[model samples]
Target: TSQHFDTCLGCLACVTTCPSGVQYDKLISATRHQVTRNQERTFSDNVIRTLIFNLFPYPHRLRPLLVPLFIYQKLGLPKLVRKTGLLKKVFPRLAAMESILPKVTVDSFRDNLPEVIPAQGEKRYRVGVILGCVQRLLFSPVNEATVRVLTANGCEVVIPKSQGCCAALPEHQGQAEQAKALARQMIDSFENTGVDFVIINAAGCGHTLKEYGHILADDPDYREKAEKFAANVKDVQEFLASAGITAKLNPLIEGDLTIVYQDACHLLHGQKISLQPRQLLQQIPGVKLKEPVDAALCCGSAGVYNMLQPEIADELGVQKVENLLNTGAELIASSNPGCSLQIKKHLELQGKTVTLMHPIELLDYSIRGVKLLRK
Candidate 1:
């Protein structure tokens, strides 16, 4: 039963496909939490869980490792290890960790965005952007692009420096107490920002943010506040789609660019936001969106599932990459960091390369009148 539950991807595709409107996501979450409390995990499982819980949710903790990671990748050590097959043979979980290591950049080491970013032209809304834990550190460019796009669309973006993890990782994995604590801290951080909406670029974090109400419903102190916070939370794409595009979108490339928008499971199934991202992308001049086969299937990056269940995640990742590539798109647009990393790793493994970027990043380039170099 534990194995059966562990293997479930928690993609919530069942929820969407169900005719009876079953809340399978909630059921799975509750079951995972119960398993954590009652079941005894193996020694290896405990170690992996401890490592993930301690490091992934804290930017400060993750930042220190980037320098070493950068050096490791720069030296081509990751490739060497893959060729040797030593790590995967010995410690598969650690091998999984190494597999999705993104190429670290200078932006990975800094938090350069200002606390208050003034809107271009007339401001239509004042919003707070949540710079998620892995997002702020690993995919800082996404956060940067998100801010630029939001500001270009006439939003005064406020990023509270005090904001930390949204606890999506813990929350998804059923570390209930830790998740609750982080959710409380998240609420406290943004409570005084006075922004009309709290925006999240990463789908996982956005889904978790939108569930603050349910997550904290039992807390007497935070029940009402969490509900209010959850009410105002919006995925960046969702907000932009609803608000409508005010900024002019220039052609990203000289000719029509065929791009595939990979739907992160959390955004599509968890938040019920399938059309908004496609609508926003189609607004860009000379941009064409392509649909992949099994577009709604999980990429198997259900939060940290890729790290914990590497073999199964890898199979799903390969299928997802194939589907995306079958679209013959020049670029792939993804909204979630975990999905991006998971797909990227599999793409690399297959000795194939495609330009994968956050939808917001592509939008940022279009709004800024920058053209992507393409063959």
Candidate 2:
């Protein structure tokens, strides 16, 4: 039973496919919770799980480790190590983990952004944004781009300092109490903002944020507040589409760049959002949107699935990468950081030069009339 639950990626793709309206998401979560309580694990498995849970959810702890990693990258050690296969020989799992680390900027966007960024022109709507746990450390630029795009299009963005993890990790792993504690903290952080919408750039976090009501259904104190909170939760793409773009976008150079839009499982299946992100991408002039062969398939970055089940995750990543490469696209746009990282690792392993970006990043680049940076 534990092995069966472990194999489940928690992508919620089955939820969309089931004709019987089965609540597979809830079932999986409950099963995983039972596994957590009842099952015993090998020492190595216990260590890996403990390390991941302890590290990924805390940006402060993660930041210290990035210093050495940043130095390693700066010194070109990553390339040398990969070339020599030293990591593969000594630490295979760590090698796989290192392959997905994005280029670390000297200063994270979180350090620069203020609590509130006022709209550029006329203020159309006031909104709150979630700066997620791993997202804040690894993909801070996405949040920065989201804020810039929102403000450029006449939305006042407020980022509460009190905000913490969306609890998607714990919730997906069946750590119900930890997930609920985090959810309660987040609700307390954003509830007083009086914003029209709560924006999230990470698809998994967005999906989890929207389900806070269900997660906290049994809490008498939080039940009503959680429902209200969930109602306002919106993926950045969903909010931007509904609010409409007020900024004028410039076309890419030469008026041509093929872009493959990879749908994050949470965004498409969990949240039932498919068209809005594509609509936003199409709005940019000179950008051609192409769908992968298996558009409905998962890229295998279902939360921590890549870290836990690296072999299976790599297989899915390779398959997804092949589909994207076959499109002959110059760029890949995805909303989730996990998908972006997973795709990027596979692209690198395959010796591909295509750039991977968040949908908002592309929109920001177009609006600012800048070129998309490639890896």
Candidate 3:
């Protein structure tokens, strides 16, 4: 029983496939919580888990570590180290992790975004955006793009300074108390803003946010509040599609780019949001939307799955990358950061040059009439 649970990606793909309408998400979450509380682990496992939980959930803690990583990348140490096979010989797991590490920029979105970004035109909706933990540190551009696209479409984007992690990390890892605490903090921070909707760009964060009601169902004080909070939670794509685009979209100045939309498991399986993102992508001029084979299958990023289960994660990522490459697209658009990182690393390993980006980023490019640059 625990064996299956241990290997489970928590991608919620089975939930969508099941005909009985079983709540596997809730079941798996509960089991994970029990494991965290009762299960024992090796010293190495504990150290790794501690390092990840302590650092990744806190931007301040994670930022300082990036400085050395940035320097390493800038000095071309990554290539040199790979060539020497030093990491593979001394620390195989670290090598696997280092291979997938995304390029970190000096300026993070936290340093750039103002408290309030006014609407570009007449304000139709006042929206609050959640800058997730890992998203803030690793994929700040996605949050920045989300705000740009939202404001361009006549939405007043309110990014509360008080908002912290959405507790997706802890909840997914089975730290129930920590997850609840963070959830409450987020609720207190965002609910007071009185925004029409709380928008999230990362699919994993959105899924966890929308399940706050279930996470806090046992809390008498927060049960109603959590439910109300969850009700307003919307993926950026979902919100944009429902609200309709008010801004004019310009075609890519460069030639038409064929994009393969890789459905983030959280978006497709967890939230059952499959079409809205693709619809938004198709709306962009000079953009050709193509679907990869097994579009519904997980890219194996399932939160921290890539880090914890690298071998299995890499296998699934390779398969996903193969499907994506077969589509003959110039770029891969995914809503989740983890999926982006996983897919990106595998593509690079396979000597592929396809760009990985969030759907909103493409929309932002089209809206601003800018050329999409590959990394």
Among all candidates shown, the one with the greatest lDDT:
1
Once model 2 is optimally superposed onto the true structure by TM-score, how far is the C-alpha of residue 94 displaced, in angstroms? 2.6
TM-scores of the candidates are 0.99, 0.96, 0.96
Please write out the lDDT profile of model 1 over residues 1-375, one tens digit for every residue: 677788888888998999999899889889999988988999999999999999999999999999999888889898899889999999998999888988998889998899999999999999999999989998998899999999998999999988999989888888999999999999999999999999999999998999998899899999999999999999999999999889989999988999999999999999999999999999998888999999998998888888889999998999999999999999999999999999999888788878999999999999899889884
Q: List, residue by residue over 1-375, the lDDT tens digit for candidate 3.
A: 544666899989889989999998998999999988888877766777787788887787788888888888899888888889888777666676787888877765246789889998788999999988888888888888899999999999889888888889989989899899999999999867879999999899999999999999999999999999999999999999999988888886466889999989889989989999988988888888888898888888888888777778889999999999999998889889889989998888899888788989889988988876644
Task: List all candidate RMSDs to the true structure.
Answer: 0.9, 1.6, 1.6
**Superposed model 3: Cα runs more than 4 Å off:** 1-3, 373-375
Please tell me which model should have the higher lDDT, number 2 or number 3: 2
Model 3: colliding residue pairs = none
Query: lDDT, candidate 2, residue 161?
Result: 89
Evaluate residue 354 in candidate 2 and report its C-alpha lDDT on the 0 to 100 scale: 89
Candidate 1 residue-wise lDDT at 99: 87
1 versus 2: better lDDT goes to: 1
lDDT of 3 at 126: 93
At residue 362, what lDDT does model 3 achieve? 85
lDDT of 1: 0.92
